[model samples]
Target: MTDIPSSLEDVAEACGTRAALALLAHFEGIDLYFPHNPRPDHPILQALGPEDGPAVCHYMAGETVTIPNRSPAKRRARILALHEQGLSTAAIARKMHQTQRWVREVIRRAGEDDQGDLFG
Candidate 1:
């Protein structure tokens, strides 16, 4: 809720008792107790909010790997193109040098079947 718009124009929320009960249930499931301010640094009453920062990626493994230069949209388009070219998930994974799971996920995220066929 930190970035909630001033007018809530871009927000979608349920507006009744059911919504209140749903929120309470969600908080209970996530262990968010009432009166708890987990992000004390970001008090709700603060006049100014935190600044947007640059995105950073860190390397974990000892092996050196080159990160791709293309943005995510480009990468997803490439995946979809390959899928349209009738490549099997395994074949796409091999051609893209990505895991079969990753290939499947890309297809799924692009609203396609596990077999890489686009769904209407």
Candidate 2:
């Protein structure tokens, strides 16, 4: 079971059929690597049933599943690791799928964490 965001699940669970249906529609054609029922042909009426249908949109989402560097600490560590591997700024940008500016910022901040103060 993938780590689905509790907020998304909670809201979908409580917001009734209209909301559930909308969420279902939003996830249309999405591929999920989780335990979900992807029976779109079952119609919206079945989604209104007393089951876990409303919450899970059959698409994987959350801090764990999609985003590799979810936290500031993890992001910094990843940046430092890739930098140590001698990857260029542009390569790191491509690997991290982040802007070159953001990658530079992470590398700078992470360097500061490790070296205390390079300028001092």
Candidate 3:
């Protein structure tokens, strides 16, 4: 078996093709090529830190899949604004047309403090 190369260019060179063509095929097409070296480095991956490395999944037999982490709490707070509009749990539930349980949960979460609020 051929060893995986440490760099894209090296891989392309080993495959007897131009690096750009290899990149285009790997990036634009359905097939994915993992490095033989096992721990190849890319500029974007380097920037994200090892713990935040991108995950790869396959859907179709040869397709690539990518999933990112959920947004931080501060970003999710935008959705909480709807609860702060002084609507009753039942009314909020009706306005959002969500289940009462969901509406209550949102209100509870919105009012929670360090000690946690009782008026959820």
Best model number under TM-score: 2
- 56-100 in candidate 3: lDDT tens per residue? 211112333231212335323533666566666676555443456
Give a tens-digit lDDT track for model 2, residues 1-120. 023343345434555445434433443322323334545444332434434443443432232223122255665678779999999989987766577888898888766767756588
Question: What TM-score does each of the candidates earn?
Answer: 0.37, 0.42, 0.27
lDDT by residue (tens digit), candidate 1, 1-120: 332222221111323333233332222112212222224343221211222100010111122223222245665677789999999999876666567887788888777334553574
Measured over all alpha carbons after superposition, the RMSD of each candidate to the real structure, in angstroms, is 16.4, 11.0, 15.3
lDDT accuracy of residue 114 in candidate 1: 46
Each model's lDDT: 0.42, 0.52, 0.40
Number of backbone-clashing residue pairs for each candidate, in the order shown: 0, 0, 1
Once fitted onto the true fold, the runs of candidate 1 whose alpha carbons sit more than 4 angstroms away are 1-63, 66-69, 112-120
Over 4 Å off, model 3: 1-79, 113-120
Compute the lDDT of residue 20 as modeled in candidate 1: 31
* Candidate 1 TM-score to native: 0.37
